[model samples]
Target chain A: MIRLDGVGQVFDGREGQVTALEEIDLHVRPGEFVTLIGRSGCGKSTLLRLIAGLLPPTYGEVRVADEPVTRPRRDVSFMFQRPALLPWRSVLSNVMLPVEIEGDKGRAAYRDRAHELLELVGLKGFEGRLPHELSGGMQQRVSLCRSLIRDPQVMLMDEPFSALDALTRTELSGELQRIKMELSTTIVFVTHSIEEAVVLADRVVVLTPRPGRVREVVDIDIPRPRSLGRNAHLTEVAEISGLLHGLLAEKEARPVDEVRP
Target chain B: MTDTKRSWLTTSPVAAVLLPVVGLIGAIALWWLATVVFGIDSYLLPGPQDVVSTFLDQPAYLLKETGTSMIETVEGFLLAIVLGVPIAVLIVRSVILERLVYPLLLMVNAIPKIAIAPLLVVWMGFGQWPKVVMVLLVCFFPIVISTAQGMKSTPVELVELLRSLNASRIQEFFKLRLRYAMPQIFTGLKVAISLAVIGSVIAEFVGATQGLGYVIQQSGASADTSLAFAAITLLSIMSIVLFYGLVLLEHLLLPWAQETR
Candidate 1:
């Protein structure tokens, strides 16, 4: 589990001091799929960085599993918008990177796990291929396998599938939901797509633009294998998407800080 | 049949190699025609046939000089790679070091290498040391710059991923940054090898008892134009061989780097 208490971040810019996030509070339960949705510069990514302990909050505290996070934790993994595979490494080598960095003592133990994860992501024979040999979607899948190879307690995904094509994005979203069920890991995924937030998250946390604040947390009461157009709860998916859209529209009228301060 | 058809296209490996070879032969043919038609003296621009015959006239002596020059080139180039990569690591790892040392590197790189050749001879004497040092000087800058740029160009997402794993500073560098920078380092090495060949030639021009450059100079004084042209031709062959040797090494070491794009 991850917890943020009154977390705020202010960055010094060339022009002046700039507020990226303010008076934030968030909690992600174990094995929960939570997605943060907002427009660019909403500080959604900044918040994710704080949770992953990649950056410290300027104000307040972030705790993971009841421990105050002063720095990154070995049990947390982060995925990026880009696959970020090393061009000189094959897929298997790229997936084995963390193990290599940590030490080779458990290399044999984790090699099988890496291969299984690769297979789970539909990249079985691709272990020998380079990142460039694959399409964009496939590259992202390799990254997914890489993140899962560590078998971490939490996964922080920052728009992991946004760079993919629309059809691939939809397909990956379904696959991600399945991966979450199989992996049973806590996840805090970030995206700008309302539909993506609706389809993938158990709870969608929407944030207001610049100097981001949690505008609303909409719960999706849909079963697994959810989709934008083909789910058993298709009507519910549409309703939740509509609700998220309205919340974003409401943000245009009222500044979150002004309303809640 | 399809392979044959495709091999004739612009992007085929066969065409890729053959086109350049054809162009080079055409250029030599044009030069030979110009000399014969204009009735130019062999003392000016000797014919290609005249140059080739000069190489045949004293193969042992000319080959020995070439071998000597080549040894210096390789020594200096290898030294630059060994020293320059670590310097790049230091600059990338420590901000204080980068701020302190980067400007000095730039200043040294900015000075014309030809200007340094005489100073090197004064300092290191007329042996192979001066030439080796000169090669190091010329090749060192591009190696450091390219390596540093490659290390710095790592995606923010990958850095965060490594951070989330709570990797040590050393691990972050050796595993992630260094691997990511390799394709680029080979790029630097390729560039530096060519410059390495040029550097030895400059050092020889300043003062040398033997080398392709010395042979060329000696021939120029004696008005043996064919031998001078022959020496120049040998220099070009040396540079071409060294450059391609590096390209081949890159292919072997980082097959994945080439596979992507």
Candidate 2:
């Protein structure tokens, strides 16, 4: 449902121009889950931002549902690593914000859907609580509810679970898989974790840092409801991890370019 | 952590009550001791007891003057809140608006509002309108600065998340930026409330025949030292009450903010 044709992002820095992404080409089919994996500053997040139209590409084009994305479209939703919950709003209100912002004055219109999203994220009983009152995991769950509340066709996530502890991360990874199955929305998620990418994505696009370009796209042939336990798919996860590890080593070995001159 | 301790202190009403009551008592004792030991002249500094007596003697008049001063303070403070938030939002929305308007705001704020008090009196005449306008001038800066800073400080992650959701600029402002800025806005409001009261009194002192500032002026002319002290005491009370009213309103409107960093 989304296509990036030679998408490149160049940022003007105090030292000079800095390229974040270069000639990147990507396509995400409807109901597909794709994860872009890379080390910090690999432009994975930049690619996601470009797809979400938060930032326009310096060159080439991004298209969603065959429409050139000049700006953010109503059918796309983005999730961040942090919960990004508004501290002043209750969980339910935060989830309902998109609807309210769309000037849907009728609370009755989206209330049932919002409630269902919250329940899907396992935040049913805590809708009235403030973001600050919840644990980090719970806050992120509230944010998930918010992102899904509008029932968008596309979901772009930038390391949405990277900040959580190992246990919560695993728990959320499972919940996310369940959510994906239920929602059936196209997703482009960015992550630095190979294990997470392997478990959650149908295809993992690995990139190198600084003028990031796709190094490889690894397909995960493992079945759904996957876990990081002693299972047959564990070998597949290990293989992907090894591939990611080699790319990271190569990324580190590349001599740092001095852009001052 | 300091935050934990603060939440603990505030969460328990008994502790909250004790801290302030103890602080007030300590301040009063210091004042009483300084007056008695130094043998300060009543003309220079009336004792707290004498000021209280003066207030009691003219309770009806003092109350009426207090009401007049309060009306002007409230009017100006409310006007500033209404105008300042939108102006701040506009500045945040556009670089051109910020560059064009920010320096002018600083210039207006820098021109000692007390100096404008007389001009306001000359233009508006020796009435409540001049006092209200003067209060607005003094209070406007804090509201504008805080609101602008708050809007500017909307978490980058949060902004990215909203953009990913295909939220419009207006949606981002109302749902995310505005809500996020509430705590900082209240911080400004708390400061502006006191300033508003002070501004009204200053304007009245410059020109007027009623209210606490006029009472101070009239007492000054007649060399009624005790009455001047009484007026000053009433002004102090007014300032405290106005500030606390804002604090109370903030607590009511944003209970969640109390726990935030």
Candidate 3:
């Protein structure tokens, strides 16, 4: 339940004003997994920041749960591309960080949830280990556990698994699907990979770069637990991925000046 | 045989301690040999044993002076941390404060600390206060610079994550920024501790009636070169001990930091 109406972002640059996004409208349904995909400088991340309330849009409004968002809402959580674990904190403590910041009186309850979330992500015995002791994939898993620890109404993930190896990325995508089945949280993910977008998203929103604007929103009819390898929906996955790839390639071919206006 | 020896030197726990001990003994032996072979005057370079016997001659007196110097060093170090860290936090939190204070701090730091030692004595008298102030002055810059740099280096993703969760500024600082900055802060601490010992000695050199630095000065006047060597050795020992103490503390407190590096 997130909505952005006519959202735009413009940054003051050393050269002049730089438009990041223009006349954007996007809505994410509750329990839905939406992935935003485009090339670099597409303002994909800028768009996410606007929704997270880390930045205010130059024009238009963002609403979450039917309320205008003037600042970050407690019921919304964001995940980053990097693991971003506190190097001094143990895995459990890092996961418990959000709750600690909230100063919640019910810490014991959150602690239990933290442990459960860690186990859900196959990090059961890693509670005492430091973030650096783990592999990159494992560290990202810790980050995921942290984001999910609060049980937020919406989770905004900005390419959370893009840093991992291909095999790990695929594995994490499947695990993410499993986790999504168990939780009703809406998710808005940003990514560079078309296959990742296709496999993970209920709907993939493709944006055009250079003052990013929504080019198309493609809905996937594929069943859950989608895989990149041999699966029942392999053809469908390839078809959608190929379509998005072509769309993105076509955008790149168009002259930069033609798209500027 | 060489390969096995090399591996043992690296892999065996005993080698870890034994190797450094061997190196130190070799250094001492070289000094003793040079004094004997060259028939070097003890006035210029006393043998290690001569220095040791000099310490034995008045163990109580030397130890008392050592204690005084140690007190000055620890006190100044503690004060530096107490003042330096908060100033760094203030600098990081506000651009206006950074702009106003940064150049001033640089100018203060740049004016050779030795040049200010006499001024400190003039202002605070020839007591322990001057020495303590000296230590604080020398130790302050490294702590502030390292900590400010560390706080400013927090990953943007983590900051965004906290913002999306509606974290307060204080919470973002204490929970994310400060914790993340700790490894670098400890780096500053280690550097400052060594400087702390030297700072106190420099102040003592200017006008103190006590401390190892004063002992060295007195020995120089009396042509008791062996005693001066003893005091110099003790100062080195103190600096080494304090530096390693911080290293040990960092190991215990931030085991994760070591792994990340």
Candidate closest to the true structure, highest TM-score: 3
Instruction: Write down the worst ten-residue block by lDDT for model 1 chain B.
Output: B1-10
DockQ for the candidates, in order:
0.66, 0.59, 0.72
Candidate 3: misplaced stretches above 4 Å? A252-261, B1-7
lDDT of 1 by residue, A1-261 (tens): 988888999999999999999888888889989999988999999999998888989999999999998887778888999998877778999998877777777789899999988988899998998788899999999888888887889999999989999989988888888888888999999999998998899899989877788888878778788865467887888888898889887746354442221
Better of 1 and 2 by TM-score: 1
Per-chain TM-score of chain A in candidate 2 equals 0.93
Worst 10 residues of 3 chain B by lDDT: B1-10
User: Best candidate per lDDT, number?
Assistant: 3
How far is A98's C-alpha from truth in model 3 (Å)? Answer: 1.6
Clashes of each: 1, 1, 0
Q: Write the per-residue lDDT of candidate 3 for residues B1-261, one digit (tens) a residue.
A: 455446777889999999999999999999999999999999998999999999999999999999999999999999999999999999998999999999999999999888998888889998899998899999999999999999998988778777776778888888889988999999999989988988988888898899999999999999999999999999999899888988999888877777666
Model 2 clash pairs? A78-B164
Q: How close is each model in CA RMSD to the real structure?
A: 3.6, 4.9, 3.4
Rank by TM-score, descending?
A: 3, 1, 2
The list of candidate 2 runs beyond 4 A from truth reads A103-109, A229-232, A251-261, B1-49
lDDT score for residue A53 of model 2? 88
Sort by lDDT, top down from the best: 3, 1, 2
Q: Residue-wise lDDT of candidate 3 within A1-261, one digit each (tens)?
A: 988888889999999999999888888889999999999999999998888888888999999899988887778888889998877778999999888888876999999999999999899999999887899999999999998987889988999998999889878888888998899789999999999899889999888887888878899889988875557888888899999999898735343222211
